[model samples]
Target chain A: MGGRAGLLIAPRILEDVSRGRDIILVTGTNGKTTTSAMLRAGWGGEVAGNDTGANMIQGHVAALCASNASRAVLETDESWMAVVISSLRPRVVVLLNLSRDQLDRANEVRRIALGWRECLAPETYGGVVVANAGDPLVVFAAQEARHVRWVDVPSSWRDDAASCPHCTRAITFGDGGWSCECGFAKPRVFSASVGATLEIGGESFEWGLALPGSFNEVNAALALTALAECGVEVATALTRLRTMTTVQGRYGLRRFGGRTLRLLLAKNPAGTAALLASLDPEDEVWIAINAQLADGRDPSWLYDVDFDNLKGHRVTCLGERRLDLATRLTYAGIDCAVVDEPESLQGEGSVTVVANYTAFREWMGRSTPC
Target chain B: MLRVAVILPDLLGTYGDGGNATVLAARARARGIEVEVVPLAIGAVIAPADLYLLGGGEDGPQRLARDLLVEGGFVERVRDGAHVFAVCAGLQILGTTFSIEGDASYPGLGLVEATTTRARARAVGDMATMVSGHMMVGFENHGGFTSLGTGVEPFGQVLVGRGNDGHVDGYRAGRIWATYAHGPVLAQNPWLADQLLSEVTGESLAPWASVADRLYLERCERVSTRRSAGDRTAGRH
Candidate 1:
């Protein structure tokens, strides 16, 4: 709302708000919201940012206009990273792992990575980049950056990075970490996410936040490293990170239909697969899907998720695309039922509800915290 | 026993083509056929199999997979009476020539008499085609417009969306089946999966349509309705 008014009042709003500010911009496919929230919390002050999962230019304009704080941690959309970097000229840039996401809308993964390589060049961007080394796409994009502090944060979603982003040859993840036959390989790292800790400069700092999932551990590690780049001590950032519980109603336990409902959001295959692995196989989980404008118009990604993880669990499918979910589950040999509403679910356990973008907001709209 | 080799899934599985292998195995196993699915990685040794599946991928990986398959003697194996199923980039990799990154054409394995050039606009939307005397439904997201040579057989005619220049869908010759349809192609059409299985077993298998079948038929109806309603998608010139 503020962005529209700011744009009308002042044509050069983005530049005006971003000028002379210690803005730390974060951009990637997954974990943008949670990682942005983590960096904001680690900042330990009234830092300006889009905490409601809005990472677009309007959101950045609004956040910047709403606060006059010296520091702002903006979560940027991957496609808009170059524009934001050129205008905002942030002191630090966080480049997370890039993967396949929203194919109907954002189709080419390599195209975006290659664009990142161009904008992140030392001549264009004069900021310190805290990037992940394990992800070949991320490493390739950030290689041209002048100052890069690499973090070897491993991601199990390896399907998107099977080929080299540089030479277009097959990338091998053998004894040499990750390398193509043409010598495109992982850069040396300053930090590595070892289980629940972030090891940097031969010392380990525990960043076990209230957030769950190994991806969360990696997020916390990256967030703390980013905070350190902005002159914040590692100890202070880790202490503040522990205080973060839920991000935009995600990772919260709520009361719904006489069951302890755990709300989680996963929009794509990689995110959904990781979220599925975090669930208990013995318990029941509610799977919801919707192909709205925000959720991408294509529902082909439903087939990409590894629903075999729900083999030992009682599963229920709901939402606008419940039938699509049912077909996927039935093919995987997992017993599932389609329901129109959450209360129609046939179970008597604390259900874990994992939903896509729009379905998650719909489910959370009619529920409250336990 | 059925031996299915998913050729270099790591390189060519950008759009859930692994689900095709899974669906093929599940269909065979449900009918009491012992199935062994081998997902061929980059450095993995190429094993002889009754059938091989290739999936859709990006331009660079498509070329890489084409080179590896040539080196692995995959074309020779296919000529030795083995069945092959490919989709999108997989289909292009088996053809005479295919273009990528706009105007960069490369030689394929020459398994099919077809060529692909970078189209003026990409095609990305719901696509349904008629193949094997049955309706097949899947999503088509590609930038290449494949031109089939004379005497090359199309697996199906275009029923709904744009398919190989808006007339046909894919190429089929003997045991080799390639298509632009990619909901794993077989998962959405049980009859095609059965037909492939029957070819290997040398038996006309009975219809074993399940919930996925019902879902597919419903989706086909929905797509047709959307098309009639003037909601047809995919970028065109």
Candidate 2:
């Protein structure tokens, strides 16, 4: 509401508020929240971050208004990148990766990347674009920037980039890099991670981080790359990033119903699949899903998620779209108990509760004493 | 083994429509019919299969898929009585011609006597159609509003949301089944899946019941019953 009123009273309020601040704009399908958190942590103090998951005008305004900080990291929604970029005129724009999520709103991944291309064009803005060298779509969008720092954020999800965005030709993703026949290929190397070694501009940093998932490490990588663009030393960024833990309560352990529950929020196919893939095969998982508007009313994307990741693990399905999820799981030869309560599931040790948007919030509420 | 080829999932499987292949293969295997699901990526040769499934995609990939299908002997195989199930952009790709971004119109496979053009508004949300004596429930998300040519039979009457034109949704002529519903429509409407499986195997499938599907169907009923679920506007993008 404040963001809207500010916009109405003064159309260029976002521009006004963002003026003179060294802003690092993070935009991507996944890892935006975690990356923003990492950026804030890497920058240590005096850095404002919009990590509330809203990522639009409301959250951006609120975050910026709360702080008179000299530096800020604003996580903008992938779809809202165009609007935010024009106003913020950020110093460094960090793109993690691109994939289809919340299809009802952003129907096509290409369209979002296209929007980014338009906003990040040389004529539009001049800033350092730190993007994922692993994702072709990210490469496509970040290609227009004057300065691009490509960081290889290792991701297993590649179903979204089956074809080249530039020529619509089939792209071949080899162990080395991905390339299309139409001269569109992974650009010249900048930085990459080889397991525990984080490579940035011919230099290496320790890969050890306080974050749980490899996805978080990817977030840290992008965040580190963005900080590098902002002239922060690699050693300083790594030390600060490793000291921080937890992101919007993600991977946060909390006791619930006589058991320790680890909360992981995965709202889209890429996110859920990545979460599922990163989990220990023997670990018990409670998969919660919902079709609320924020979660993209269509739960059909659940099919795209490889439940096979949980093949060796005991699984329980719950939440609003549990039936759809359970139905999807049954076909994958994984028999999961569908329970109305996550507490009812027979599990030992720390139970990993993976839920999409509303389900995550609802479960967080349930775990928190009413 | 009955092979269910999910063609160009990378190009056209954005909506999780590949789940339909999983549902089909699993259901078929449970009925004592061995099945193999072949995920056909681009440039892959078209193999013999009992059923070929195509899902929704963006405009560029949709046209690329149509052209690839033409060059990959997909139409010839379909002409030989192979079963094909397509949804949304898949439906558009199998048709005669479809318009995408701007005023640009691209040629389709011409396998189905249909043509898709950009509508004033896109039709989205819960769509229902009474098919095979039951409500075939699914969600429609597409900017293209399809119109069937003469003599082409529609899959069902539009009971909830705007389908093919508004009064109807989808195309069913011989072995090919196409609709605007994005992905996993088969899982939502298991009867439709069974009907397609039965046609492919040339065997009668026994009645199969699933607690999850039953619950899903009940919810689909509840959603369709509510006026808020369907396209309140004439169409939506």
Top-TM-score candidate index: 2
Q: Which stretches of candidate 1 lie over 4 Å from their true place?
A: A1-11, A346-348, B232-234
lDDT against the true structure, each candidate: 0.84, 0.84
True contacts kept of each: 0.49, 0.74
**lDDT of model 1 at position A121:** 98
- Give per-residue CA lDDT, model 2, range A1-370, as digits (tens): 7766777787778888999999999989898888888888888778987777768877788788889999999999888888898999999999988998988777888988889988999998888899898998888998988888888867787888888888889889888688999999988867887788788877887788877778887888888888988888888989988877677778878767666788899988889888887797668888898888899888998888877778878788898778888888888889788887665755347788999999989888777531
CAPRI level of candidate 1: medium
Error of 2 at A245 (Å): 2.2
Candidate 2 error regions (>4 Å):
A341-348, B227-237
Tell me how much of the true interface, by contacts, candidate 2 captures.
0.74
DockQ of 1: 0.55
How far residue A282's Cα lies from its native spot in candidate 1, in Å, is: 3.8
TM-score, prediction 2: 0.96
Per-residue alpha-carbon lDDT of candidate 1 for residues B1-237, written as tens digits (9 for 90 to 100):
789999998788888777788888888888878999998998887889999999988877888898899999999899988899889998899899999876988999998899998888788777887886787888888888889999999989876777777778889977889899877677777778888889877877666767777767877888788778876444443
